[model samples]
Target chain A: MEKKLKIVGFLCNWCSYAGADLAGVSRFQYPADIRVIRVPCSGRVNPLFILKCFQEGADGVLVSGCHPGDCHYQEGNYYTRRRMMMLKDLFCFFGIDKRRFHISWVSASEGKKWADVVTAVVEDVGAALRGSEKQ
Target chain B: MASTENRSEKNTRRESIEQFLYRLLKEGKVDAVLVPKRHPGGNIVSPVLISEPSQIKGTDPLAPVQTVNAASIVKELVKEPVDKKIAAVLRPCEVRATIELIKLKQLSDESLLIIGYDCPGVYNVKEYMHGIENREDKEAFTEEHIHDFLSGDGDLVRESCRFCTYFTADSADVDIAWIGVEPPGIIVAARSEKGRRMTGGMNTGDKDAPTVRKETIGKIEARREKRQKSGIDNLLDLIQPCIRCYNCREVCPLCYCKECLLEPEKMGYTSERYLSRAERKKQIRMPVDTLLYHLTRINHMGYSCVSCGICEQACPMDIPLGTILHVFSKKIQSLFDYVPGRSRDDELPLTTFREEELSEVEDV
Candidate 1:
């Protein structure tokens, strides 16, 4: 049996966070593995913050901001994308599996897409947990 | 053994020192000489800028073990208007660090005529002092031990000097490069117009001997071999004796921080917790940051470690800080064709953003 993996997700309030809230109102079911922290803009995440979370033992991390040009702050998601891209590259250099982290462009209106992304990421993290245990 | 290269230019350091001072004083180029002068006390020497040549003739090239990084000094000087060019005899690392400081806008090239040396390596103040303190005549003990202390076959060099590969001066406006070829002097490879112009009328000739450079490299490698396993053991060992003291920063020539991120009064510093319950009270200041202290300084100036080996020399506990610095500098600079301090203008990889760099990227 795979142990429950604790996943932390940084969801931008205008997009992913609102979409997550909509999933609840729409009665959609997703895995409870993720604990979401809402931020005004995804660009607030620094690589140091991510490294700190990993160092303090988070099994998986998901960062969902608005779609590329659809940031509530107009350019916030674009900046977040570049920073997270660099952060993931750093993690890969340390031999962390790509499957353990997720970044997506979910919009405020895309509640169904948010539910689908959560289901997929949670299952992927669950599978990774199993694989790491065997090794 | 005194490097055989020391003999050829028999009066090279002396001549170069005289020419630089003459240019600075007679031509009004610089205000002073920021080097160590010896006192009768034997162990105590301080960083002073000599305006008069008579004052600098007493410069203890082997004693005082300079801890003030000439790199940071150049940076400080750059802040003011250049009333005159200040010719500084900096270690290769300090020269490179000065170039970097200039590049970083901390220093200006106009105010400095960097006189760099082919460093044979210097001793930690404490260790050299101990050797002196244990002997009958402190000055004689230091003079006698300079060879044994720096020689690889003799007592181990300060760990910083052992791992450093750039003992020769490769970059500087004006260099008395330790060609490490024959003895008593360097072959003087003029890499810059400033160096070439300075030695224009001299009998300085080309080094047709490739074997000499290779031989010097062979000596350096022999020392580097003994320096292995020192990197890991040294960094881990720094946890003790570090005491979170910022003395290394104060002594370091490159560690110029008007407002450092590590200062507790800066408002962002978080209090650290210690693992040992018995040692908890002793850990309040948190050994400040063994990793960040190394990492941030490297980030800020990795491209400039001239391998001066001063950071380790200043460590109170004798931590081999310079070895760890060189390790990271070596790994980081391999990506850029640019070796730190080798050039005054190479842009740092981290500081510059490239539109087409295609640097390491993770696959989706």
Candidate 2:
């Protein structure tokens, strides 16, 4: 059997965590690769956490928060958007495969959308890992 | 006007600067002036805060040695409210770093006057200490350095300084310029209203900044840019020898965090956790998280980095951290169309965001 790829997911408590919970309750099946960690808001996710995940042997990382204006704390995800954007650029500059890192806006009501997002992210991460292994 | 023969005998430029600093003290223009002076028994030149006019005798404002960034000292000097005004003599990079600190709220500029100068770069600290070990006339050594630098031979300077484009103090309040002037002539150019007021009675030379100065700076800028492009490749390989001494962070002027997250205790690594990590990875680097430290530092302060190259100087492993950080930060700053220390009014890139900008960062 092949070893499982470890993907760390940071989900904002207000929107993304609720969305993931809704996906489970509604039986919307998605990849089981991600290990979810709840955060107060996307803004609370320091870029250090993402880098730390990579340092600790995580194969991929995902950060999900509420839509820009729909942030529970009001303007939390906006800061996350900017921070993550810079982090993404930094990752690329350091020769990290950008596809292994994903950012999304998931709403509490969007259970099906969350499931689809996870499936796509898992596929991308798997492909990226395989591509790097070949090289 | 003295003859060329007389100029050759006396170090006129150093003497004139010493005279200017003495006047600043005697005339009470500033309560004290912060300038570099040679330590009593060594070739080491460090920043000294001199209040007495007589103490300005051995101070060399144009010394080809940078012991510390000096912005960190400036930060410490004015961290709280002070009653006295101080004039800080600094190089172009030091002034830029000071401006960034002012924006970051780490340093207050209320009681500080930044006097910057045209810098013909300094040698690396180790190289400088070694080069001047047996020299008796330290002043002659500096004069020879300036002569070589003026003649466009930058081979003896630090690697970072050789490729540094900001060799003049354009961002400073008062700029003491000598790069393009005839020998022994220095021009004091006041850049701001505060500068103008502070230098009110001082007689700047009758001559305007020569056109040749601009041309010289342009040529240097072009050459350095080309050098910068070719020198910044293979960053990972360059940092391979880093011993995780944290010297780079200790000496960085911009790293003002009270408690750093990179500390060993903060990392929370137990012996069991280390074994587990090793087991999981099949093998692990002994002093782990070195790459993480560098990357995290880049992410945190890359936007505010002034490319002073002090970090490279402080590294025990001789990592070309200065070039790596400089090149990386240049790219990161360009993303937001921002330049650190360019202006006091501009908001830090990480602190502010546009509601309508960076739409591509989000997927789905």
Residues B1-364 of candidate 2: C-alpha lDDT, one tens digit per residue = 1233344576667777788889888999899999999889869898999999899999986778898999989999999879898999998888988999998999778888999888878888888898788988777677777776766645768877888888888788888888778767788878777888887878585323588887877887887777774325466677789888889998898999999999978765899999998999999876887888898889878899988889988998988888889878887888899878777778898888887888788764
- Cα misplacement distance, residue B245 of candidate 2 (Å): 1.8
- Fnat, model 1, is 0.02
- Which candidate has the top score in TM-score? 2
- How big is the positional error of residue B29 in model 2, measured in Å on the Cα after superposition? 1.0
Model 1 per-residue lDDT tens digits across residues A1-135: 546678899999899899999888898888888889888888887655555455446888888888766788877766566556544543433446778888887887888988899889888877877797799
Per-prediction fnat values? 0.02, 0.55
Best prediction by lDDT:
2
lDDT of 1 by residue, B1-364 (tens): 4443333435534445445445446444456666655665656655567787666555644352555666766677667667665667777667777776676677667656677665655556666566556555444443344445345524444666656666655677655544444333445445678756544544244443567666766676676766654224334455456665666667666666678865645423433323442254343344444544544555545545555667777667766667666665554455445676667667755555344343233221
lDDT value, candidate 1, whole model: 0.62
**DockQ of the two-chain complex in candidate 1:** 0.18
